[model samples]
Target chain A: MSQIFHPSTNTLSKVSIVSVVLLLGGLGYGLLALNRSPYVARTKIPFDQPVPFSHKHHVAGLGIDCRYCHTTVERTASAGMPTTETCMSCHSMIWTNAPMLEPVRQSWATGKSLEWTRVHDLPGFVYFNHSIHVNKGIGCASCHGRVDQMPLVHQENTLYMEWCLDCHRHPEKHIRPRDKVFEMAYQPPANQLELGAKLVKEYKVQKLTDCYTCHR
Target chain B: MKRLPWLLLIGGSMLMMGCRQDMHDQPRFRLNAATDLFGDRRAARPLVQGTVARGMLKTDTALWSGKVGNKNVDQFPFPITREVIERGRDRYNIFCSPCHGLTGHGDGMIVSRGLKKPPSYHTDALREQSVGHIYNVITNGNGSMMSYASRIPMRDRWAITAYVRVLQQSQNVKVSELTAEERRKLEGAQ
Candidate 1:
């Protein structure tokens, strides 16, 4: 049994132990990075639609109010997608023959839905209501970002529980005046935290972090 | 038996590498999501023909139809308050001002972009028209104007009608109607 293991074997065993620890740590870090990446979080990635609709042209160029198209946003659970009639309301006259708007014309002619791709998709378990947020001093820009600037809309934030918790835990960081909820270019004022604190009380926004608040 | 635990460890971890989305996307049709139950694949079914929801009977000829006995009434169904005028102004800016213009001048952004320009709201003919007539025009299409009934609710339509009157009064104000301060400001600007 003498000299079954060489002197170098002792160094090899110690290095092997250290290498295993390093490998596991690297694996854990990679998983977390992957979890928050664009692949999983779907942030900053634009989706393909049947027709490329430009929010920039419609919202910023035309100065149309969000409520003009999303009519039920203030009262409904989901912010309503505009109907074909809403599209044709203007396109019927203005962009009558634009090749890009042919799908809209066809949808109007056929009385069929345009099947606009949903941009903000949360998990089914999370029960988010647009009206409640809109009424509670949470501006549309707070979550949707500068939609007036995006030709093709993309998610601005990770729709992760941690991201949601960050806002729910401290809503005073983002709350705005109720009148400015639909205003796209609304900037948080210099005294944003102070104003938000006053608005949080006036709007009666509860720091609802209970699991059932969203899960149910 | 010794190798079975190692095999289970590797297999269990491998399965979890790709997180299951079944929980994320539960088996339910979300709003506007596609469905196979209908020919159109629309989960939101259209209202059955002639089916009226509760409190939506809409039998008031004056309020809902903007007509009484086949004539556009001259009176507003509800009294126009200052708050109502403000609400009307807000709603008017959103939906009507696109084509009607901010000051009822029929020179809105859309009109500039080549939609048939609507008539100015300050004309004597329009000034004499009843509020109900304007309400009727909004409810039903008039000329190139599409029916806004689907977009504006009944109350909002009246509010907008009231606001249209405000715009009319604002543009056609008589020189004598202005206060000394307002008269000076108007003359100074010119």
Candidate 2:
């Protein structure tokens, strides 16, 4: 009342209001950008497995089929991990004394499994089946990117709900011949949409939009 | 006004943190996790004795085990229809052809990659071996071969055996045994 307040107090209050609004707006945008970034989503971040199994060496260089190790991809809910037996089938003779494969040999000898870290993990609520996808003509490369090129495996797709829905809604765009499911180098033909449509009918693929299709 | 924005920011972050606990701390047993509620201390319960799961009752020994009275049967339990053979071909290509080779030559891609090369099915030893032996190998796994029983169902195992027979026959067909029409086709192709 007695000139205690500065003459510029009103201007200071106005500036404070403008700064607060700008800060909040920037915060929201930053959060969204970070959420969608590959860094946060863990795409292309190679995980350290117990054994440094290289998809590049096995699948690309040696030309081993995906089904050789992932034996249950076409028949089970999960693409089963290879047993120690599967690894030793070759390693027993090929790289018997390689220090890198000592863990594999130990696991085989002790009958204990190597604890390989999983890369593409979905949340508990989400339900995904490798067999259904493979049997319905989804090529390994469609969702996994060029795994044959990666020396160490990494998550290629965001694996977010929105990412799944994109393919689920327009599955024809992703579908390939069933024979090509394991083909790492498969590419969509010029008439992919047409081929996809034909396959959708032939494979009887349900265009599932309900939450239960995946969530349950 | 300055105090109000600071309070709002703190409250929003607190609210977000509160929501995290519900899903992450939900009561559930993870695979092979230990649990005190069970006597075995295993989260996974053992199947009750004599309780067979639905669609898993293996009453027909021949169909399920490819054997009759502890001896491997020479014949398939079911009729070898064309469709069954085709199904066998598909299953064989996926499962058996990896090691046995598409032509049963024991020269599958794996063999070239330096895994042990299995004996060729075209060899007289394997050609004369009973179909049941092939089926037994698939079900129980032979030396250096992993058992495919878990990966391939019993019916598909039979189908694969049938396809292996087809492969063996393809490689060892006699010119005199060929039908007149088949002989003509072979001559023309040659």
Candidate 3:
């Protein structure tokens, strides 16, 4: 009797086995890439807002300090969003008639809050504190990027556990002088590691890699 | 029929991988998050009228109101030190310098941008004004200036007031009061 299968059956079965493994591996990789993509993470993507607030104009041009509007950043867990009154503080005089600031005027007139789109919302479980970071010598530009240059704010870094751990593991790599924490154009000096090492010790920044550090 | 188990396994695994957001977005309100449950749609509720949180009752008329018995006090509630002055300088640069100018010349960037120029700190009227008066202006605002009470804390307002005094002194230093060494340094700049 003829063999149960053609002689080429051996090769076919062998090739199928390898191809199945390759296909599964590719799918796994694709899913991970998709998870980290801009679509999912919203990194570097600007969101539409009720008003076109420009950090570049306010921070770089007008030289307004971050704390001027985000008043509670240095003391509270949330970097407080400026109230409508904060906007009208300047807009009431400067851009009194600019149509671009109509929503601000409306909010001021109606006593309603402007619904600003959040840019750097982390997962709910992550217990991040801005005051601790700002007080511990982390410059605004370190994580927020050149906000002074961004016409519209966007997420400068991927809000990923791995990315956060990268800094939390070795905070010296990003630490700066406390005085320079709000400086938007701050640059790491030539002796960064040297200065950073000293600062890390002086600031007592712990390498908090434990799960509870962020998760709790 | 035999292949049904394999299909079910693959489909079940894909469904499981589709979502794990239960922990990522637990049912809780974050700061400033919008809510539909309230008529105002604000996650954060305004404090009720006359509601004072613990440790927030502002009873010190001198510190909170910058006045005692309806008169703005000339003395600060707390003693000023070098450290306090430095902190004042820091806070002043952030909140006050934008409209008041670094030298208190009333020509800050905001002034150039068309906001009414604030009065120079070196003006005789301002120089003679008590510290608490300035703090009151910051707390309650004056003329076109809006109230900064919500922006600057009580201690920081006093600190800024102290720094404003320093700026006034800096710009109005008497030439004869300069020491020989300081006068030489000033002359060398020219």
Q: In DockQ terms, which candidate is top? A: 3
Interface quality of candidate 3 as DockQ: 0.75
Per-residue lDDT of candidate 2, residues B23-138 (tens digit)? 53347764445567866465768678999989789988888988888898898899999888899998887666766678889887777767688899888988888878889999
User: In model 2, where do residues sit more than 4 Å from their true spots?
Assistant: A1-31, B1-9, B15-51
Interface RMSD of each: 1.2, 4.0, 1.0
Q: Please provide TM-scores, in order, for all candidate models, with all chains considered together.
A: 0.91, 0.83, 0.92
lDDT of 2 at B56: 80
Q: Which stretches of candidate 3 lie over 4 Å from their true place?
A: A1-27, B1-17
Error of 3 at A179 (Å): 1.4
DockQ of each: 0.65, 0.27, 0.75
Model 2 C-alpha lDDT per residue in residues A132-211, reported as the tens digit of each score: 99999999899999999999999999988888999999999999999888889887999999999999999999889899
* Fnat for candidate 2 (0 to 1): 0.23
Model 3 chain B TM at 0.91
Docking class of 3: medium
- For model 1, the superposed segments whose C-alpha errors exceed 4 Å read A1-26, B1-18, B184-190
